[model samples]
Target: MFGEYSFNNSQPASAGGHPGPGAGPAPGNLPPQSPGFVGRERELAHLGHLLPDRRLITLTGVGGVGKTRLALRAAAASGPERPDGVWWVELSPLRDPGLLTATVAHTVGLADHSARSLDEELCAWMADKKLLLVLDTCEHLIAACRHLVGELLQSAPDLTVLTTSREPLGSPGEQLVEVRPLPFEGPDSDALALFRRRAVAASPPAAAAFDDPGRATIAAEVCRRLDGIPLALELAGARLRSWTLEQMAQRLGARFDVLADSDDALLPRHRTMRTAIGWSHELCEPVERLLWARLSVFTGDFDVAAARAVCAGGPLPASRVERVLAGLVAKSVVRRTEERGAGIRYRMLDTIREYGHDWLTELGEVRTVADRHAHWYLALAQAADRGWMGPGQVDWYRRMTAEHPQLRTALEQLLKCEPAAAQEMAGALWFFWFACGHVHEGRGFLERSLRSGPRTGTGYTQALWALGLTALLQGDMDAARGLGEECTRSADRLADPERELRAAYLHAVAVMMPGDSVRALTLAGPRARAGHGGRSSGPGWLLCRLATGFALCDLERFEEAAEEARGLREACAELGERWLRAYADYILAMSALGLGHHGEAARHVRAMLSNKRLLGDRFGIALGLDLLAAAVAGLGDGELAARLLGTGHAWWRTVGRPQMGGSPALTALRDEGERRARAAIGDAAYETAFLGGTAAATG
Candidate 1:
């Protein structure tokens, strides 16, 4: 979901590349390949043969049997054949099936701007593209995967899906490719090659000893004892740096024997895999084991700050976590990698994470660690909220987006044990949810927390205010009004002017959205005045001013609206906040258009568009495009205006909203722009231009 789009004649540098106009560099979403990929030539060749004929291929095997690696290799090898390239969607971080469609849509670069369902948008986007979509780690969400894959293959004839799971997806047309463990018997076996490769990298001394036939026999026995599973071999090989091959082999054999006796219920391969991980765990120092258990709380990759905050205290000191983490990485128990623009992040493989989770449960520290993780993320959300109106707004957005999975995990845990904390945390993340087009997910959290939490205090008031705003954006006026009224009552009882002002702003926006300008003005005017009387000067106060400008414009008070908008724009400029300024620009642009200042209106619209683009605010961008098209229409470029309208409509669909609420004037302007453009160009020509614009937006 996060990469640059380019046009390239040669092979793309990235994995998933979608074909663009004129055969530029393709757009793709494949993750980078793992380092030191040893073998799988036969599997790759088999995949190459199957892919051309099969639309859906499932690489099924036990955990750590190299299914994912084989899939990645096959997809990359087949990239040039498919003009749309390959897309990789990692499902390990996903917990809810409801988010599957949206996640896939985002990965494929489909913005949910239209009011259409995510599935509709995805199907439309992929209908003409020839690509491979790799769904990784699907066993946990097999049912969702089956349904989604079935829908996708039915809708897109040219699209191919490659999935890696412990079992088949069970969807129709799914070709099963059962991945077996690398062979340890032959002299030139892949398992031996992988073991030697890892051993030499882990220790130069081990590399020297491997040259001897005696040592080679020991290494072969070690591989055989571990059943030749790539993950097991690598973990075993990591110990060669500290222990002799014979020693590691003896320890692994003992551990596996103990595990086999203890858990005969598990499948043989599963028992082997868990035994290898448990052997690795036993070799770790006490502090290392403790850190591993604590680190299991994270759902995805984490940084040192997260590690220190969540995994420290209780045998693992905060100051020593970094060193212990490095040790774990060296031992192949944890993986360390550098994420683009995010510096270094650490992750444990799914199998390893499960082992750690089991240990954590045995230790009875699940609640304690979960609470710490929630608290840290709550602080992070609050910080991001504070920074949203400053220079770091975009950075904060990206950080919050990257941390979304972990935040969701935290919220789920908190909701059960500490509902009040859930309310506060969910309220704190409102800006991220709103700005990033996570309306459905955000509303769910807010509603659930509000229902379960106590109906008093600042946290509850904040939750109500946040929920009201989320509903307002979702066009649920009844829910918004109910929440707004509740927020008002709670704020008044608690004597919290800030929450009260926010409630007034919400109510005003709710009424203004439906064309009640006079009532909106009355509701917002007092709050705006109160906010400006040194009572509040944060985001809420700015929003109050924005609502006031919208009401004034809706009442046809152009001059007054322009003046208020300009003032708010200046204030936002001083505060280095673009979100509110974009709205202010929209109000100013509308006023200028109404007052017959075409050039001025165009400038304001362009400014709004630039700001929204900078913030990645798709909804704002759509509204700005509509206004810009209106300005273009007024300036006598109806053809271009029609195209822009089409582009704007496309973006609007991605946002799942037809138009921004609280401004009938703006809506009327959009309608007028469309009518004038169509009249000037004729319906046929207008339709052609509009479709062209939609194509351009999609590209």
Candidate 2:
């Protein structure tokens, strides 16, 4: 039942520096742009006309004025029109001016920047390439960006640069596209169009309401208040899911007065967005601002409990979190999002959230804020870990996986400030290593977190166990054995049953790294059946059994492996383990594939993928994709095989797993499997279908 997992590490050409005109966008390239490109047909055509001659074209607009989305849409639509490729460069996290050029170069896969000035090398490289470079969100680094774009234009006349900012570059040969707010006329206007789109997203039936006088008026008002900016309108409309029209009007009135700053010097409506957001924030109570500051800790949408844990304190009671959240939503300070089967959640726009973060920091509460951020994430990691190991493991992972970006951001900030806390964070995320198929990420963080602090307490014990499990997953026998032994010794001294259970599971799994299927089965079999109480039986012990069973199947011990999987399933079901069932199904799928039961294998693989996908488990979903691809290939369905493989490749890229680094044995097995499939289908046909399928998948 041991199906191997892999990820795609291919970055975009602009990011990974892969040289080939026909070479596709780098892996994990830009996510699919929203199909919400409205009223930009004229702008897009204008930009296209200028693209042939001008090497640098920039779209300048106020924040929330749809710069990034427009640029992204233009790039994707124009990618095929360009010869080299369309490369989008998002330059927001780059702070140091000196590292600006290096950041660009590193993204394009340039190694050893110390050997040459990155600017010079970048210019030289672009001179020969006919690609379109879309530099997004550049307002924060305007001067450095202006200089770089100017030099690149001078040197690489054939290359095209598309930039988005709050202001123009004001450079020679620059075709400045001054993006204005959508025109808020009747329903047909751009502003109204954007509002209708957002309203439709909130309530699909609202699409028909566009023709209604009252709804259209409100939509127009919303568009006008938001200054026809798509992001702000979307934020406004999202609140409509719960808010009434009258409430919206009242809030907008307060927002406009505050945002407009009636007595201040007159400014462009777009610039007033910041003021509008400030007004919205001011409408929030001290607790709302506090919650806003804490929400800034997340890089993506977050849950209510997370907000409560991180943002609550100082005059604010955690029990009143729901009310504060309601206030923020009422004022449109926090945007709510829905998760299937999970309740509604909230987030702040990057720009607005950053403003609140700045305010929080200025209040001399950064350390306190940082502490809350760490503490909340520690709780998050623990919950995710527990979810992964419990029933509905797949579903739990899906819910937890949705929070991956936010969790990572929290942990990163924590590691930066209190490196010692990283130990707990890493340990807490240990189940993620095997369950989500994120062995590499799990290993990297575990190693870094452990090295950051001395080996002691639960944190140290957890780290040791995590390290061993990661090694075992990657088939690093020696490292796994050593770490496993170390983990067991540490746990023994600690005398913690939970820790001991985890360490023993790792030890059992490590036995398989040395190709000892019998020993691994002997060591992990009984433990695999042992109940983990609230923890899903799918963590170390179950994963070890699955892997060992796969090894046993390869060694011709099919009956033993199958029996073990069946036995484990029964135990898991008795414990109400829904998540463990998915893993068991995956193991059975692998065994069926090995046994040449193609149809059965495909069914099991599909089940596993569906289960994991529902739970937001990207890692497991990727593995399921890989298994499905192989299963289809084994079934002689070349077309289906190619499609599954392409999807698997995309998911792998998103996960950022590298080949030939860990688990050489599993990697080789996959390579051999791919080779065998290719030999069966013929190389030419497989390549054609694979490439075509990959192209379709990316689109």
Give lDDT per model, in order.
0.79, 0.65
Worst 10 residues of 2 by lDDT: 13-22
Q: Give the per-residue lDDT of model 1 (tens digit) for 41-134.
A: 7888999999989999999998989988889889888888776667788888787887787767756645453434667767776787788899
What tens-digit string does per-residue lDDT give for candidate 2 at 277-305? 66556656687787777667666677887
RMSD values, in order shown: 4.2, 9.0
lDDT of 2 at 248: 76
Model 1 lowest lDDT segment of ten: 1-10
Q: Indicate the TM-score of model 1.
A: 0.90
- Top-TM-score candidate index: 1
The top-ranked prediction according to lDDT is: 1
Clashes of each: 18, 20
